[model samples]
Target: MSALPTTATHEPEAPIISAVKSNASAENRVHGLKLAILLGSLTLVTFLSLLDTSIIGTAIPHITSEFHSLPDVGWYVGAYTLGAATLQPLSGKLYAYFPTKAVFMGFVFFFELGSLICGVAQSSTMLIIGRAVAGMGVSGIFNGAITVLSAAVGNEKSPLYFGIVLGTSQMGIVCGPLIGGALTEHASWRWCFYLNLPAGGLAVLILAFIHFPELAQKKTFSMALVRKVVPELDLIGFLLFVPPSVMFLLALQFGSGNTHAWNSATVVGLLVGSGVLAVIFILWERRMGDRAMLPGSLVKQRMVWVSCTYGMCNGCCMMIASNWMPTFFQAVKGEGPTLSGVHILPSILSQLSAVIVSGALISKLGYYLPWALGGGIIMAIGNGLVSTFTATTSVGQWIGYQIVVGAGRGAGLQAPLVAVQNAVKPSQVPIATAFLVFLQNFGVSIGIVLSNVAFTQTLTQAIPLYAPSVSSQAALDAGAGAGAVRDLVRGHEDELSGVLRAYSEGLRNIFYFLVGMSCIAVVLSLGMGWVDVRKKKDSTKSTGDNEAQEKKVEEKSLNEA
Candidate 1:
């Protein structure tokens, strides 16, 4: 609300201060070098974490084949996500207590160790454990990157730096599937996990040498401060929050198809239990005051709630498209993982380009709402176009559809983060940002699970109708087996073509659902109020006041002479 006192004013006697006394003479040469190094290190971490999500998706079939447990494949991805989502809020408190650099380094180490375990894993169980471990590190890495960026640049330059970090991160998401596909096709799927080893190691090295002034140990560890803030960590809130959240996700992912039926006690119980726990967590948070894990004020902020909702919707659409589109390519287009990844390239590239462009524009214009709304609308349109795809759709048409979806995602992804960062106070930035990430993650998990359910159900119903001679039981068996359905259909080209058409139809249905979801996102984006980057306003006013005061000082000196 008010301008933060400039460092020049805070430390008037510092020798370098004189250089910054006037606008033309101002120099941040040393600070600029430090910022570049820190940003570079953080960018790598951001890229790798996002890259893992898509890269692994492209490698899922390979992992399933090696483990010979197709049913358990979801856990490999789910475990990592669950771990990351669970630890996100905690990372905020950890930053408050520990030296940020040390914590960041420690987390990267954990991430590398997890990558090593995953690369060497001989069984699904081992891989799941590895994923869980990697997720813990990932949770810290992403949150840490954002926290460090804000602290290093301060509020005035934060949006620009945040945009850069996010934009760079999108590159990892774009490249991940292609990289994973190439490795899976030519070498081994194991390389997907192994790739992170070198990348993570490089990031660790960069961070070790890069001086982040924000993370420097300012005061000796204070037991009193720790004691004061410990209650705010909301251990009980987490206890209520995590188990139910995980259970709800599990119910969504595993309770469909062969794992459990919608009517079954296992599915019904987990879903109901999760709901009750969520309600309890909210109540507990309300009772805890500042100690609440999610403060009540967070919900009251219209911008925060709207931005979060918009993020959740966009996240849902993005995940659904990313996860299922590859499968569609394999099923309908008869493409391998490598080709499927390549086909999706347009979407990934567009997303990356859009993010960078949006970041620059936001920095220059100092507004985010219009971009947010435009992004949502474009995403809706793109998703709607994708819903029209049929088994016989041309490759060019497919590529076009992908490009549209990518553009929409790219435009929208960074807006919510900008909105939240702009709306909250500096101290609340980490928690607020974490909350946005949490909702996005939760939305992604939900989207994948929901889309999978819809796809499975549609395939089940259509397979029998489209290929009557195949028999319902046989179709079910084929659907359950890894690659067996494709192999079977490959042998009976004519009949299988019909079944593939049905699968494509089912996919189109799921895309339609995504389109509707994205439309809702667009509506939510429209509700994000107006862009109001707090520091920008204060900086402009302060600059004007300073200029006017300087003129008065110069006039008085002249009159005295």
Candidate 2:
């Protein structure tokens, strides 16, 4: 990868030039009203960006119904994460070379554009494209928000600003289901995507007024700059990374379906070619060594490996069944979208509460390992119980089961980050964080696909046995929507019971997959050696060390990227 270009820092003499604002002392990054405005806008942007991750959960059934694309269910959820995971590294580099404000605004524009496309999507393919585009934008939105915030503020007050941002992110996650449900039920599902426009516009408008701090070094754009930027972005590595991954994903999408047998030539060829390409990619990265997108020296570290793997496992545990939670209510229980959202509130709220409580406790006690280990075990138990849920399961049992799963997830989701952060030196924090974050998203995408495969295969068989008279494909065509499957066997109590039973079997398989994921998480957590965050040196010494690290980071421009 090439280095970011350098020149004496100054705004270009152009209309689009950024109005450079200088940062203040660590005591107060920005004072009074200006700081308030910046933080508020950043918080809103953070909320808007993270909101998309969860908002679509409640709306998925509606989307599938409208598009009548049961086979594409995984794509709807996974496309965003796939885009985000692949583009994630490049976003940080873009910020390094490009104007911060311009890059940030460009990301917001992409996000809005995507939302508009999704709002008016005519088919499953269009919706997936919109989701992918939005995910691409989201890959940078949160990072850009932080970068802009970092420029506006100083080091000392960083925690407070980040707290606000993170808190808002939590709010976005919890609120997404209800908002999507309400919109899907009362308004139109399209309204769910449309709503992002006004909110995101407000955030963008607010941000335009805040002149960001100038970089220590920057240069004007030119042909030479583009050449330099390409190398810095690791274009070859990115190219190698995306194609094989897509092929592998395609294999998963078609391999277990009725449309394609597991041993079909297309599936086999994709699998074999993907493996060869993956091997080539690894070899090229090894040859590139430090220049690789995933630098060999860094990845070889035990903690980095553990953090990424552990995080991926935790992510799998969380996402494998989450997309189907609403489907359970809507399809199995005959609940409306709005009521289904209401029903899922227990999981969301419990997870949120657990996150807060665990964060406080972990900070106070100074040990994250116990929480990480215990969380996986609890999540495994929760997933097992969840898999046991049937069409006739009682309300309290389902709610309590969801609570257990949520609590388990909340308790451990942040633990891997701590492991990664503590394991790296200050200068390496950015790269480490980026790697973990990418793997987390990668995990979500893969887990969702796995869920889809298991559900598809299970339901394909179950449908034939239960609704023997009704065709399997036609039943699946019902799109897992409320009463859609039941509608197929209307007035036939035994058939309705059998059909619902088939759905319950498939959905249960998804949750059972999650149980295995949680167990893997447990093993990974065991591999993460204990580290106490509270055991730091004296404040003055720590500050001096941080200054030294900052100097190293300044010398290495890629660190900033």
Best by TM-score: 2
TM-score computed on alpha carbons, candidate 1: 0.83
Q: In model 2, where is the ten-residue run with the lowest total lDDT?
A: 6-15
Residue-wise C-alpha lDDT for candidate 2, range 350-375, written one tens digit per residue: 88888888889988988888989998
Model 1 spans with C-alpha error above 4 angstroms? 1-40, 64-78, 122-126, 146-166, 205-212, 215-229, 363-366, 468-485, 532-540, 543-561
What's the number of clashes in each of the models? 0, 2
Whole-structure CA lDDT of model 2: 0.80
lDDT of 1 by residue, 1-561 (tens): 134222333322122223322211113212667778788889988798888888876777556545654445446666777667767777877775666788788788878888889999988789988987888788888778876775676656777887788767877877888998889879988899899998888888878887554533333458865664455466777788887877886787565455687778998999999999988887776665455666667767998988988988887777768766766676577677787788888888888788878877887787888888898889988988888887788888988988988899888888998888877886577678888877776666566666766766677678777876565445444432226456656656568776776677778888888888888887888778776565666886899999999999999999999
Worst window of 10 by summed lDDT in candidate 1: 21-30
The Cα error of candidate 1 at residue 425, in Å, is 3.1
Best lDDT among the predictions, by candidate number? 2
